[model samples]
Target chain A: MLKISGINASYGKIQVLKNVSLEVEEGSIVTILGANGAGKTTTMKSISGLLKPNSGKIEFLGEDVTGLRPDQLLRKGVALVPEGRQILAGMTVLENLEMGAYHRKDHDIASDLNKMMERFPILKEREKQLGGTLSGGQQQMLAIARAIMSKPKLLLLDEPSMGLAPLVVADIFKIIKEINESGTTVLLVEQNARQALKVSHSGYVLETGKIVAEGKSDELLNDSRIIEAYLGRKSS
Target chain B: MLIEQLINGLTLGSIYAIVALGFTLVFGVLGIINMAHGEIFMFGAFIGVMITSTLNAPLWVAFAGAIIITAIMGYMLERFALRPLRHKQGVSHLAPLISTIGVSILLENLSHHLFGAGNHPFRASFAEISFQIGSITVYLVQIVIFVISIVLMITLSFWLGKTKAGKALRATAENLETASLLGVDTKRTITMTVIIASAMGGIAGILVGMAFNSVTPQMGLSMGLKGLAIIILGGMGSVRGAMAGGLILGLAETFIVVYGDSGYRDAIAFLAIIIILLIRPQGLFGQKIST
Candidate 1:
C-alpha cells in the first residue's frame, strides 16, 4: 500500500506538482488519468524518488520514503518502469532483464529469470539480441518483463501504452490486467481514459498538478465532466 | 627491421591502451573527462615507489598497493568534488574538469615538494632482466608490463560482462536516472567507476615507472594528454575502441621515433587524430551517445 499526501515537486523555480495526493491499497491497480502537461509523470517520478518533493509525505508499505534515493526505494521493493522504455540499448535482452533485479541478492534468480522468459516468449527467442534492435511492442514487453524481474511490491508505470499501435495497446493493457490479477500492486499513469478505467480498481483524474476527481473505476468512467474532457465526448 | 619495430610498438601500445581504457571507462560512466586522470597515473607510480622503498613489498604487492591507494583517492575526489555538482545545471560539466585539474596541480606540487622534482626509480629491480629473440632484445620489464596489461584487460572485460555490479555499471553508463530507478545506487556507481578508472591509471603508471625507471610529477600531464588523444582517436567512451586507438597511437609514435625524429612524435600523433576526426568525427568505433 502507498499514500502520497500534499506533495509538491518542481523543476528548478517552475513548480510541476502542487498539493498532489493519492493512495493505493495493496494489490489494487490505481490509475491516474490526465492530459498532456497535467503533471502526471511528475507525480510518478516524485513517488519513485527521481524527483524529490519539496513538501509532502510518500509512505510505501508503512515506511516514510519521501526523500529516499531511487535505488533505496528499489531496495525497499518499489520499482518504476519509466515514461520511455529506457532500456540499455547496447546491452542484450538478457542483460537488460538482469539489470532489472540489480538490488536482489536472492539465489533463485535463475528460476525467476526462467519464469520471466516463460511469460514473454519473444524475449526468450531474442534473449541474445540487443535491446535497441527490438520492435516497439517487443521493447514495451521487455520493459514490463524487466520490471517484473525485480519482483516489486509496488510497480509505478508511466505511459506504458504510449507510441504503440491500437492492437499493441490492447495487448499491453491485457498484460497490465494480468500483472495486477497476479497480485502486484500497480500505479499506472496514462492518457488512455477508456482503457485505463476498464482495468484499474480505482482511478484519479489529475488537472494541472491537482487531483480533480477520485472514485471507483466504473463511476469515474461514467462521470459527465470526465466524459466531456477526457473521455472524448461532445458536451451537452 | 619491421618485426623489431612492431614488437617494440606492441610494448608501448599496451601501456597506452591501458591508460586509454581508463579514460574511456570514466568518461563513459560519468560523462566527465577527468583531467586529473593522468595525475592519478603519476601518483600510482609514486605510490609504487613508496611502497617498494618503505614497505619493501614484492613487485606484485607494490603494483596492487599503488592501484588500491590511488583508487581510494579517486573515490574521495568523487565524493568531495564531483557529487556536489551533480544537480547543478550548465556549469556542472566544467566543474569536474576544473576540479580534476586542480587536483592534478595539487598532487604534482606535493610530489615535487616531497620527492624534490628529480627522476625517481621504482623498486622493481626485476626490470633490469632482458631476453633476446632473434636480433630483437626485449627487456623483462616490457614483457612483464605487456603481459600484465593483457591480464588486466581480460579481468576488466570479465568484470564488466560477467558480474552483476558490472551490469549495473553499464546501466548507469547508458542511463543514470533509469539505472537508479532500477535500484542502482548512482552515487556509489559513480564512485566505483572513478575507482576502477583510477586503478587502471595507477597500473599504467607503475608499468611506465618500471619500464623507464623515471618517475616525475610532470609526467602526468603528457600521459593524460596522450590518453585524451588516444580516446579521441578511438572514439569517446568505447573500451574496445580505446584499446585499438591506443595501439595505433603507440605504434605510430614508435615508428616515427625509429625512422624519423623523436621530437616529431607528439605532432604526428595529434595530426593523426585530426585526420581521423575529419574522416569520422564520431570516432573509429564510438557510439554517438549524448553524454
Candidate 2:
C-alpha cells in the first residue's frame, strides 16, 4: 500500500499540487481522473519523486518515502510509466526492458524478459528495433511492459491511453487489468474518465490540485455529480 | 613517401579522433559543452608522466592509471558542478560551458604552478624503438599508441552496446526522466558519462605526449579545438561519426602538411570542416542535429 498526505509540489514560483492526498491499496488499480491542469500528472510525479514536494508525507509500504530520488523509489520496487511514454528512443526494445530491471540482482532476468515478450507478443518481434521506431500504440504497450519488467510493487501510469487508437487503448487496459490481477498495485492518471473508471477498483477526481471526490469505481461512474462533471453527462 | 605520409596521418588522425570521441560523447549525451575537457586531456598526459616517472610504473600501468584517474575526476566534476544546476535548464546549459572553462583555466594554472611553465619531454623508453615495414617506418611507440586507441574504441563501442551500464547511459541520453523511472540513477549515469568521456580524453593526452614526446599546458586548448572540429565533422553525437570525422580530418591535415604546406595544415583541417558542415551539417553519418 502507498499513502500520501498533505503533499505540495511546484514548478518554480507556480505551485502545482497543493495539499493533495490519496491512497492505493495492494493489488488494486487506483486511478486519479481530472481534466487538463488538474495536477494529476504532478501528483504522480511527486509520488515518484521526480518533483520534490515542498511539504508532505509519502509512505510506500509503511515506510517514509518522501524526498527519495526517482531511482531510489524504483529500487524500492516502485516504477512509473511516465507521461508521453518517455521510452528511450535510441535504445532497442530489449534494451529498454533491460533498463527496467536495472536495480535487481536476480539472475532470472532472462526468464522475466521472455515473460514480458509472452505478455506483449508484438514487442518480441521488434526486440532488436529501436524504440523510437515503434508505433504509438506499441510504444505505450512497451512503456507499460517495460515498467512491469522492474517487478515493481507499485506501478504509476500517467496517461497511458493518450494518443493511442481505440483498439490499442482497449488492449492496453486489458493488460493493465491482467497486471493488477497478477498482484501489482497500479496508480493510473488519466483524462479518459470513462475507460479509467471502468477498469479501476477505486477512483478519485482532482480539481486544481485538490481531491474533490473519492469512492468505488462504479459509484463514481454513476454518481450524478461525478457523471455531470467527469462522466460526460449533461448537467440538469 | 606517400605511404609514409598516409600512415603518419592515420596515426595522428586516430589521436584527434580519440579526443573528438570524448568531446562528442559528452556533448551528445548531456548537451553540455565541457570546455574543461581539454584540460582533462592535458591532465591525462601529466598523470601518465607522473605514473611512469615518479611511480616508476610501466607503460601499460601509466596508461591505465591516466584513464582511471581522469575518469574519477570527471565523475567528481559532474556530481558537484553540474548536478546542482539540473532544475535551471537555461542556466544548466550554460553553466557547464562556463564552469568547464573556469576548470580549464584553473588546471592550466595548476599545472604551470606544479610542473612549472617549461615544456616537459615525456620520454618513455618505448619511444626509441620502431619496426620498419618496407619504405614505411612504424615506431613501436606509434604502433602501441594506435593499438591502444583502437582497443579503447572497440571497448567503448562494446560497452555502449552490450552492457547494462551502457544501455542505462543511452537511456539517460535519450530521456533522463524515463531512465530514472526505470531504476537508473540519472545522477550516477551522467557522472559515468563524464568519467567515460574524460577517460577517453586522458588516453588521448598520453598518446599525444608519447607520440610527440612533449607536453605543455596550452597544448590541450589547441587539441581540444581539433577535437571539437572532429565532433562537428562527425556530427555531434554519433559514435561512428566521431571516428570517421577524426580520420577524415587527420587525412586532410596530413595531406596538406605533406603536399600543400605545413602552415596550412590547421587551416585546411578547419576549412574541410566548414565545407562538410555546409554540405551535410550533421556530418556524414549523424542524424540532423537539432539546435
Best by lDDT: 1
What is the C-alpha lDDT profile of model 1 across B43-154, one tens digit per residue? 9998888888767888888888988888898887788877777787566568877888888888889889877788887768686687878887777877898899889888
Please write out the lDDT profile of model 2 over residues A1-236, one tens digit for every residue.
Answer: 99999999998888988898889999899999998999999998999989999999999999999999999999888899988888778778999888888888999999999999988899999999888889999999888998998899999999999988999899888988999999999999988888898899999999998999999999898898888888776432
Candidate 1 chain B minimal-lDDT segment of 10 residues? B282-291
Which pairs of residues have clashing backbones in candidate 1? none
Candidate 1 local Cα displacement, residue B63, angstroms: 1.0
DockQ of 1: 0.60
Query: Over the stretch A32-142, how does candidate 1's per-residue lDDT look in tens digits?
Result: 999999999999899999999999999998989999999899888888888977877889999999988888889988899999999899999999998988888899999
Candidate 1 chain A, which ten residues in sequence have the lowest lDDT sum?
A: A227-236
What is candidate 2's lDDT per residue for B69-151, written digit by digit as tens? 89987887787777777777357567767877887898889989877777878879878787778877878887787788888
TM-score of each: 0.96, 0.94
Candidate 2, position B240, lDDT: 84
Backbone atom clashes (below 3 Å) for every candidate = 0, 0
- Top candidate on TM-score is 1
Model 2 misses residue B117 by how many Å?
Answer: 2.7
Error of 1 at A26 (Å): 1.3
